[model samples]
Target: MNPRILLWLAVGLVVWAVIPFVVPRYIADLLVFTGIYTVAGLGIGLLLGHCGIVNLAQATFYGLGAYASAYCTVMMGLPSVVGFLVGAVISMALAYVIGRPILRLTGYFLALGTLALSAIASALFFEWDWLTGGTLGIGGIPKLDLFGFLLDRPSRYYFFVWIVAFACMAVARNLVDSRTGLMLRAMRDSSTAAAALSIDLQALRTKVFVVCALFGSLAGSLFAHHASFVSTQSFTVDRSISFLLIPVIGGATSIPGIVVGALFVTFLPELLSKLGDIHQILFGLALVAVVVLMPEGLVGAFGKLRARLAKRGGGNG
Candidate 1:
């Protein structure tokens, strides 16, 4: 929509395309991590942006995918490709079943229920010794092989991640322009009015919930394969908080906002961690300041600033 922003995105893609080729493997990894976080955040955008659902159990879907892949590949001896798809399907079915009842609630009640689900999922990951290896997590996840070709190198894996990230963004953009996306947006804006007009509120919310779960699962599958390990710490309540934090910080209404928010939240912290305790304190303070100053979000603030400058210029003319 904004030509300037489109130009910026095109430039960014160009940078991303060149970085792995030029940068060291370890540094390239941080960018990969950012991409992974953005992919997961886009799923949160689908629910929070389009569907207007604050799903507190998002990390459960993520953990489910990681563990599912671990179980299928490491335990069941399945191929990596099969294991990945299986992970997503398992998360989808699980979310669909749970969302049936859970989707009926609204506001605080739905939040509370999803929060409870997050706790349950974490507990299972820790307690299910036989199935999940309990608190120890899973390691030595086999590197993916496409026929005779083995994708064991970091450079090769980078392509896998980038391609998926682009695909996820494309899918979200497409869905937002479709009939289902329109229905989700309408229901999100007002269930009461939607119900008045005969929208099946419960069914619609349930489907969106499944969509969130499926995307989260997709991110999780990539994560497990890339890291070659799965752990409860990697997909827990705090992790879910970070996932929610991104779209809110970026302005949930726009895809670019979520992507930017995810990148900032992911790498900026690690960069600050190197600067000592004062930096950590400043980071927290900065977060609070941003929330208070830009409650409508970063993109919203920028839009307002642009409008104000335009108005001032017109008056001077």
Candidate 2:
């Protein structure tokens, strides 16, 4: 909404558009992966940050997108575009059904309940050999073709992912600026106080959950097509936690923070993998530092700092 943000966003989009012409393919691939996962992370952040819902079923929904897309492509022989919509619908429905009951619970109890959903999904992926190809995994998935155009390249996927990420960010930014966002903040602070005024608690939370889920399913569809191969491993416990950490590390207050967080969570491993076994330790330690020192998240802390600086400048003026 601000001109400063619009300017930066335009510049970033331009850079993404031109990246393939200048950047190496491998680096572009890395960025592409980061962008796709960032879309998923952004969805998680939106739900958790605004709606005050901690979701463990993100990977489950994501896997559904991937699997749905796969089924569409392989079984129905349809293009990924159609598959993407179908998969997204499935995710939205599942989230809605689960959210109706689960959203009422708060704190760790809600968390455990959602975590169960994820566990069940992962189990199905592993056990349903007939549909998902079981532990052996599904391979030889054809490249994603849109309108008969092959989007099998990394840079292509990057552009695609960037578009989706930008769209999700736009939605989130709008929500933050709108009255609905204020309502979510109210509920986050105290549901009793919110309900005292007669807020439609169930509908409000359901809307947010479905919106967040749309992003998750879209991210999953992109992931499926990008990898062209997926399995139970793609929706593992580690991945769920990793996706959750992105917003936490980045600060959940704004989309920019989540983007930065996604960058780190998506890639810090290869950056530290020269030490091989020590990479996980370093990653864990870094996360711990983020938790203990920057608990409000990086973006959130920056917002506070900016407000303080503005106050100081105002006094000086």
Candidate 3:
């Protein structure tokens, strides 16, 4: 490992440790959501950046996980781990079943298919009020208890959530650096050539899609436990759109970019809300600015700037 990288890691650890204690309770709460969003957004990032797939059905899996956790913990009186496992299994299963046909679609058509899936899932969540609790939602979801330690506060929960996010990020990094990642990139850049090489395109795409759903499910379960409630409103098409934006706004290919994007998504709205009702309009404009000016996202733009500075230093040297 690089000494500089280790140093930066140490600094980051110190900062992370200090933040919750220094910040207001609400800000700490937002940080928890940022971590949750990062986990969810990572799945989308993997698909979009590596597989060249725009998955808009992430919210469906997210809802499934939340509902699973909610119903199991509250209604069935099952253990929380059971709910997490059940949600992950169901989400992955659904993704496999849906990805087979939809993965055949190219570009916009594929995107639309995922969007339609999200719409159908949202409708089902609303209609199946008996199980889902519909507009009223499921409540009294219990907080996680690791051994005897209770994660009842936002600050405590923040660490647990981000740890999970980091684990997911590590998995994504491994995937991106592996042979399957090479196949994905080859397929993304030139599908014909990849196919000529006898790569199983559909299977590969479905595999990534299933992984994406798993991440979504995990994030949703985290959200359910953190919020202590699950509702149809949180799992709508709009939420899926927001998840999509995280990868786009941060840099789809960069793991750290997911964290950056989650921070932007979680904190920006709160910052803008101070300006009253115009916050929504301002937020929209900000997003447009990011998309138009920094097409590769904030992380990419920073990388470019860093390269430029290094070049200038070398020239001077």
Candidate 4:
């Protein structure tokens, strides 16, 4: 691990450790949702940012995990942990099945394929009344009880969610630093060159797609348990777009950037809610401004600024 990363981790640990004690209950609850969204954002970052795969159907996988957990626990009388596992498995299987063919397409075609899939999934969520409860969705999901300890309170659940989020971040960071991650970057930079190097593009793409879906699955499972509810409204194409925007706005290649983007996106609506009917317009404008001004993302822009400032400081000295 890099010394700077270690230092940042230590500092982050301290901050996370202190947040529950100092933050208000409502704020803690918001943070918990932020953590969930952060995990989903990480998945999007892995696919879109790292692998250069534009997946517009990420929310379908997320919804699958939520619905799977809801069905297993609420309908089948399973334990929370079992439901979580079942949800993750379902997401992985579905991702594998769909990714094999869909990942072959690139650019706008790929985006359109995912968009169509997400639309179909959203329609299914509405039509599958018996399983998904139509528009009302599944309710009464049991709280997560780990080793007989129930995470019933917002503060408690906040810690739990953030722990999972950080664990996911650590895993993503490790993968990004590994050879597989290097291969992914190579594929992203130039699929032709990667193919020339004998890299199995299909296999690698499938693996990363499944891995990305699993992150969304884990997050959805946590969300189902945390909110004690699962609704079709929560998992729509719009939600997928939001997930896609997080990594792009934050800095797709940087794990910390995803987290920051998630936090920003999660709270931006709430902060803008007071702006009456023009909030969405303002939000859209802000997004356009960010993309135009900072093509490499906010984190990358900051890093570049810092490097320039450091060089200037050295020159002055």
Candidate 5:
């Protein structure tokens, strides 16, 4: 392992170890949601960041996972863990089926296609009365039970979500550092050149799309189990947009940026709740400001600052 990666792992371990003791239950719950979004955001990073594919229909897969998990646990009487796995498989299969045609479109056309997919998925969530329970949603989904232990408390769930989130980050990091990651970067930079080099553009695109959907599905499954509920309102175009914003806001190129962006979005509303009606206005302005002032996003900006400081220190020495 790289020394820097090892150092980061050590730091992350410390932070995780300290969070439960230092933070209150409410804050811990917020962190739990943050973890869920982090996993989802990492998926967004893979598609939009690494592959330069704008997947505007991410919420479709997310909804599939949540609905699948709900149906499995409630109707089929399966365990939450099994439901989670089933949700992932369903999301992957659906992404493969839908992504093949939709991904064939590029740029704006691709975006539009995904937007249409999201709209259609949202409609189905509302219209599928028998299976999805329509707008009424499915409730009483079981809590996650691993072996004999049950994650029924906020603190327990906080740890569980973070564990899964970190595992996802590790996988994403591995992908980003491998030859496949190199191919993704090349495809993103210039698909034409990549294709000319015989890079199997279609296969690569489809794989990343499925991977992104898997991450979203995993997050959704966790969300359903966490809240013990599933609703159409939870997965909307607006929500998909939020997931997209996460990588952009946090610096799509950096894995840690995804988590930072996720936490920022998760906590932003609560932090601004004191402003009441003006909170929405403030949130929009804040996002706009971030995009305008820091085109490379928060993590990229921070990295630049760190490099500048290091240069100054080297000069002084």
Candidate 6:
């Protein structure tokens, strides 16, 4: 690795260690959400960036994980890890079963199919109030105990959440650098060419879709523990859109871009809210600007700017 990269990473680690202590409690709380969103958005990033798939059903898996955690830990009195595992298994199974047929659709049709799945899941979350608690939500979810150390506060929870996010990021990086990633990209660029090359597009896509579901589920489980509540509103279409935006606004093809996008989604809205009632309007316009002006996202645009500056400096020298 480059020495400069190592130096920057060390600096980032120092900053990460200090942030929870120096920042306001609410800010620390938002950072926790950012980590959770990073986990959720990573799957979308993988599908969108590598497989050229637009998945809007992430919230469905997210909700599955949240509700599973809520029901297991609160209602069934099971361990938190069991809740996480159950949610992941259910989400992955659903994705595999649903993806087989849905993966057959191409372009906008596939996008719409995923959107419909999100909508249906949201409805089920509402109608199945006995399990989900509907508008009332499930609460009193206990804090995690890691070797008798209670993660009862935002500062403590922040470390756990981000650790999971980093782990997920590592897994994503591995996938992206693997041979399957090449096939995914090939299929994305030209399904016909990939097919001619003997690639199993359907199975490959379904695998990625299942992986996406697992990420979403893990994120939801994390959210449940952090928030101590789970509700239908949190798993709605709007939330799904927010997850999609993380990759879109952060540069889908970049692993670190997922963190950038999560920060944008989590922090920008909070920062804008200080402006009062017009904050939503401002945020909308800001998103529009990002889409219009920086089509490749913040990370991509920054990379281009850095490259340009380097070229200019070299020319001057």
Best by lDDT: 6
Q: What TM-score would you give candidate 4 relative to the actual structure?
A: 0.95
- Model 2 has an lDDT value of 0.82
| Residue pairs with backbone overlap in model 2 | none
- Steric collisions counted per model: 0, 0, 0, 0, 0, 0
TM-score list, all predictions: 0.91, 0.91, 0.99, 0.95, 0.95, 0.99
Judged by lDDT against the true structure, how good is candidate 4?
0.89
What are the per-residue Cα lDDT tens digits for candidate 6 across 63-135? 9999999999999999999999999999999999999999999889999999999999999999999999999
Identify the runs in model 6 with alpha carbons over 4 angstroms from their true place: none
Q: Which stretches of candidate 2 lie over 4 Å from their true place?
A: 1-10, 304-317
The deviation in Å at residue 105 for candidate 2 is 1.2
lDDT of 3 by residue, 182-225 (tens): 99999999999999999999999999999999999999999999
lDDT digits (tens) for residues 43-146 of candidate 1: 88888888777878878888888888888899888887777788789989999999998877888898788888888888888888787787788898987776
The Cα local distance difference test for each model comes to 0.82, 0.82, 0.95, 0.89, 0.90, 0.96
What residue pairs clash in candidate 5, if any at all?
Answer: none
* lDDT agreement of model 5 with the native: 0.90
User: Model 4: how far is 3 from its true place, Å?
Assistant: 8.0
TM-score computed on alpha carbons, candidate 3: 0.99
lDDT of 2 by residue, 124-154 (tens): 8899878888777676667866677778899
Off by over 4 Å in 1: 1-10, 146-150, 278-280, 314-317
Cα lDDT tens digits, model 5, 112-163, are: 9988988899999989979899888999998888787888877888888998
**Pairs that clash in candidate 1:** none
Q: Residue 241, candidate 2: how far off, in angstroms?
A: 1.0
